[model samples]
Target chain A: MVKRGAASCLLALALPAGAAEFNAALMVAPEVDTPNTASPYYVGPPLVPDRASRQDLELRLREGGFNVQETLRWQTIRDRTPEQHGIANQFYYDGELGDGLGWTAGKKLMSWGVGFGFKPLDVVQRENRRLVNRPALVGAPVLAVERFTADEAWTVAWTHPGRGEGSDDFRDASLALRWYRLSAGGDDLHAVARLSHRRGLEAGVGATRVIGEEWSIYGAALYERRTRRLMNMLVGNGGTLAAADPMSEQVGGGGTKAVAGAQWTGASGWSTLAEAWYDADAYSRAQWQRLDALTASQHALAGIAPAAAIAGNVAWSSQAYLTPNLLRENLLLRLGYDDRDGFRPYAELLATPRDGGRVWTIGAAFEGNRQRLALGLRQAGGADGSAYARAPIRRAAWAEWRLALF
Target chain B: MSRRLAALALAVALPASAAENVAALLKQADAFRLPAESVRVETQVELYKNGALDKERLYTVYVKPGRRSLVLMKSPSEIGQKVLMLADQFWLLMPESQRPLRITASQKLLGEASTGDIASMTWSEDYDGVVEDEVDCPVPPPNLPEATAPPKPRRCLHLDLAQARSGVTYARIELYLEKSIKLPIKADLYVGSGKRAKEAWYVPKPIEGQQRIMAMLLLDDIQPNRRTVVHYRSIVPKAAPDEFFNPAALVRNSLSGW
Candidate 1:
């Protein structure tokens, strides 16, 4: 039914009598990995297996005062069971409503905040953890209205039936508003407020300024109230399932997240970015030590049948509670060189300062007239009780080929 | 003295006085480089490294002197990128970004060419010129299809230009202007330490419905074997809407393929 709906929307966009354009691409990627432990936790087969392929199609149309855009993707993974999925990535219609007002409605990807890697105000979409090099966010259905002048803009949006993990039903939707300003010295300032039926109120502020010819700095901070709190699940005496004990619960206490970053670009096409992220709700150093000890005990009990269930529960709890930048303090660094013609090489490092754990990714891409080829390698390193010590895959290598079609 | 001899000497002195004023020569050259009113043009640039094609890009530009100018990238990797210049300020917009980013004019755009080099052409407004010399120079012929003869040496005015603005990329430049048309023929750019950084050649091309003018520019790096050629394909004289220069329009017309 979802596929049929997407097809209908595509047809509707195509039927308009106006100038339309279409673009498409096909990509095939293959990878190999080495697990950190012999018995690794599996999450229903990896989304990207040893080999995977994807096809994407995009269409755009402009008629009168309205603009329409649509993108569709089909992906398949070559695993033991072979999995496939089709997605309507983005479809939106934007038009002016007179009186300096404009509106957009449909499914679309929206991004907020000023951080390069970690965004505190980007609440609509869940971050893709597997691929840290590129952002892969799912679009949500929304209606947005905006008004603009020379130096200021005001926007209000309503999102219904959010598609990601923590979203609830259509009845429990979200509303957001933002005010953006550009100062005389070319500085940007933004203030945003949001209300979710299930999650209470949230507010955020972001700013960006250019320090000199080669440097730019940006930061963002967000506070949320009445949010869901993640906790460790407790097992019963006989290893029986306890319905009363849940992994997460709603709490009245509020939490805050902040991120700051800077970027520098040189005259020779070399650029670097550095960012630091902080999560107030993250586990402290002592709490993380306690969790690590509990995990060790659970691993030792995996042999006993009755205790095996409880061990699985423990593993699930650890996965649920561990979030990106969960070590309270984290840093990200990215370095890249682009000749702008075809060749580009980049490297990224994500480090947990408190636990001394880090993940490094390095890649290079060469682009031709109609094709692109890329090769990448990723490695994770940490101490015994560090954040990445229990990572499923310690090292991995991958290659991808993409061909453009019009 | 004879009356005829005195008149002849006066005529010679009049021409010499006109050539001595380098400021007038610069003002004339600037008039030939920029259009009097707003104009839109399509441009293609090719960069060569070691005599081999290294990169190429296409752009659609709208220019209104003393007001604002907008350049929209149309080809290669960054398809929907744009650059807006308003007086001393510059902003950049990427396809996926929501706000325009502030940028510096000295940033490199391609081989040997800075963003300011491609965006602004009225050199007279940014530099103060001093008369250096007047000598015979070998000038390339106008960029017309029928011209095939090798360039013969002609009398040209040589002038030294000092930057008048703080954020300009080059501190000093030596320029050569053709005596007949008062058009720039060649230039040598100098950096902070007074070292020659690059050389530029202005080639004249005939506009379809306008006066003959130099419409193509070539910049060559002094150290590396690199060169960039910019060709003004077409120019249409018309004023663009005010919104076209607004940064907010970058997001509102994100899908318009501007």
Candidate 2:
């Protein structure tokens, strides 16, 4: 169906248009991955793989003179320990039809507008890169808004993932339309209202005001009634089900949760992100209580004497599971230097305290016009056993080489 | 006594005639007042590094004045594939990536003498200061006085041209005005910020219904690091619809092939 739809659209457009121009770029990347432990799947965090190897081939094309873009990625993983192989596939497509109407369907990062609800991507060497290796494909419907403004954009169709597989399978789905208008005091007001379905029924509303050229603030709130299966996926342990068994038992509760947060960014390339949310376990309504979590992140580019920068982020989350009191704390520090000659060097560190355990990671990345190299060492150990360690004491090293392709 | 009186009168009239001629030439150069309607120009640029040709550029330009100009590159597409010129703005449309970029007024060095150190250049503004006698020109040409060597192919006017009226004027220029036309054929560009460190060549073409002339080549090839050159291949004075200059026209009227 996907192939036929794309082919027919091209054929129809090619049939008798009086000489319109079209161009495209084809990018292919082959990647390798290694994971720790028996599970070949690695989502968030890094340096957990005991020994695994995976190669990925991805192709990205921007056709129709850059108005249409499509990407397809196929990856296969071979777990040395489990002696098993798994495949991860992804596809993304975004099309702009001139006057604002557009479409986006794909596996992509789900950042709810202002890097709050979900931020799975990071910028590296002036390019947006993945923070988490695992990706979810959530097909999105796009609606254009503020057509003539510089900041005009289209809101993605869905927020939460839905059920099933392929592009349409999302755990949460959302449809939103955003428009910017003038406020009473001449400030710009951007607002969005989205009907998003997570496991159950979820909806959200958000607005932002540009106080001045240097400052802008935004806030959003979400109300959700999640499905039992979705809750089970989040809280349930890894297990296999009996084949052809319809009455198989699944774990986790189903209930509603409300979330809210605000963010502020400045023109000096300084951005401070802070968000606090309370999740009300709708599945376990009998034990319903408010759980609070907050995250603070700061990023700034400095051109001072060293011509480097200092960026840090700290996050804390209250216990979400009832069986055990688990408080999550995370800290990340990044320092880097850049110059016009195309030489850039950076160091990164991440420390996370989960339950009653601690994990720390330190790494450095260097890049230049002709070469790119990265090395990192990670150690995670604690009294309750290592959160990512084989036994509570874990250490690992990794390095990579990049080849430029025409 | 009659002979002495004749000599005195001759001396007086000679300076007066020379001064008038200088004034007329200045006026002719200043005739580049209103913008042209449409112009087509072919240019050849030779890049010189330490007195040697390193690279070259050959391109054609189409200009609808106050509206837009399109540069169709003929050679070295790797250099500048296609360039679009508009009033007060110009964009370089690359064939490889095919992206349009907004450039500042300094890029005018690569186009018709619209704006530059020569923006205010005219017949009147440049030929001021001391008016010399016909003998001052190199031998054998109206503007070429007989002071320099004939073996040399070109001649120049070395004059101290400080603006007595305003501070925005250039000081001390060694000008090479074409012998036939009393206009600056080429000039040594300078500033208080820098020396007479850059050389520019002006290829001239006679414009219809206009005095003085139009620029055919505005090449700034002396500075190797800042390789800025403009070639005005053909220029025709013709009017255009004002709407053609609007941003709406940018997307409405796509590039020729596109």
User: Best candidate per DockQ, number?
Assistant: 1
Model 2 chain B lowest lDDT segment of ten = B139-148
Candidate 1's residue-wise lDDT over A253-357, tens digit each? Answer: 788878899888765668898999887656666656655555556555666645646545545655643465556788999998876456789999888888887
Taking all chains together, the TM-score of candidate 2 against the true structure is 0.40
Model 2 alpha-carbon miss at residue B121, Å:
21
For candidate 1 chain A, the 10 contiguous residues with the lowest summed lDDT are A39-48
Off by over 4 Å in 2: A1-49, A65-112, A116-170, A178-193, A199-331, A351-400, B1-258
Clash count for candidate 1 is: 0
User: What TM-score would chain A of each candidate receive against the reference chain A?
Assistant: 0.84, 0.48
For candidate 1, give the lDDT of residue A88.
51
Two-chain DockQ for each candidate model: 0.21, 0.05
Report how far residue A133 has shifted in candidate 2, in Å.
6.2
Query: What would the DockQ be for model 2?
Result: 0.05
TM-score of chain B of each: 0.79, 0.49
